[model samples]
Target: MASVQKISTCLWFDTEALEAAQFYTAIFKKASIGRITRYGKEGFEYHQKPEGSVMTVEFTLDGTPFLALNGGSIFKFSEAISFIIHCSDQDEVDYFWEKLTEEGDPAAQQCGWLKDKYGVSWQVIPVEMVDLLNDPDNEKSQKVMAAMLPMKKIDLATLKEVYVRG
Candidate 1:
């Protein structure tokens, strides 16, 4: 059989997989929910749920593949791996920063790292950040990094000011 071209990311939710998927799909464009299969009696788990309950809930976020599973709530999203959004300008950064940062969860870090409401990490970086970081002057780049360290979504103008000072 020919290999199918498909990509998927599995998300473990504490019995909130479907709700989370719906919330996410509604926020993003070109995204929608997929099939949600419930558990059957034969495969059901004794303690909580059936064996097949929410085996997989496939969906997309801005064309990116994703799957939400109704798994235990032992683990939640953290600051380890984050989504990097290459923003063209401040408006784009503000847009994503405002939307993803609902629910009063907003923390800023250096170099464009932020924690959203769902505890999911995000990086709203300006496209110019690459060039700034790659500057030949180590001191200049370091200075810019220092300024960025305390920021949530990077401000291009502020970064430029720091870069010029170096």
Candidate 2:
């Protein structure tokens, strides 16, 4: 039996709820689309969306449940919130960086952070980064921070090299 999640993150989109859910599921392992809800006639007066249009899409990404809502253009995505992908190695980091940035804005790329085609922000970071940044040696941590500050897509190999050199 599947256990229920007490909380789930919700993503707001301007009529791309279903598409975004599908796209996210395709990218993450162990992910799948679940229930889909459409706007009903009862809420037409307030929502103003087409009654039959998608209202929400439930999905799981790497086992974490999420909801995508077609909430109209009144709200827009901002840099304040972002999903972080904790990559295990260079391969994982490279894979996410390439896939997520395929149709994304190149101008928005900075310090391992990117905005996808859907305008959703993501941070592709190596799991080892935490340890490197938390090192007891301040100089070592500073070196790692310097190497990371100028990178768009995180280079795990380069980070590792800097850590060793320090």
Candidate 3:
């Protein structure tokens, strides 16, 4: 069966399209690198990338297709957009938190969000957070939110503790 993805994400990198794709695919279990396009001498005046150098690399991460473009240093990633990974438990949360935060922006670690080494922001959220936030008891939800606000790597145990203490 042929699968089609009508919508996919495109990431712009200074010059690390291949490197970033490899990094992401290595971290995610179901990830893989696909087609790679190279630049030619025809566009040297504009792209400046060496002839035959990587221009774009198509990749799939955890089943989501993404395109990484070596678009030069014109555009940089910001915190406005982030990928969220809903972990089923603390172990899952910790695994992603440790992997994504490697040599990343330590200061950006807050409320389950962290910037990866490639300056890509990711949120390692516990699956229970959704239910906790949607809880009918506003007080419990508020407490959980408040506790999570000050955390760098969200502790599922702490959130669970707060909920049960109520």
What are the TM-scores, per candidate, against the unseen true structure? Answer: 0.80, 0.94, 0.96
lDDT of 1 by residue, 91-143 (tens): 88887777777773644444567676556677777888778988999999988
lDDT of 3 by residue, 41-146 (tens): 9979898899998999999988899999999999999999999998999899998898889899999999999999999999999999878877999999888988
Q: Which residue pairs in candidate 1 collide?
A: 43-51, 44-50, 44-51, 110-149
Q: Between candidates 2 and 3, name the one with more favorable lDDT.
A: 3
The TM-score of predicted model 2 comes to: 0.94
Instruction: List per-prediction Cα lDDT, in the order shown.
Output: 0.74, 0.91, 0.92
- Model 2 lDDT at residue 40: 86
RMSD of 2: 1.6
* Candidate 3 stretches greater than 4 Å from native: 1-3
Best by TM-score: 3
Clashing pairs in model 3? Answer: none
Candidate 1 TM-score to native: 0.80
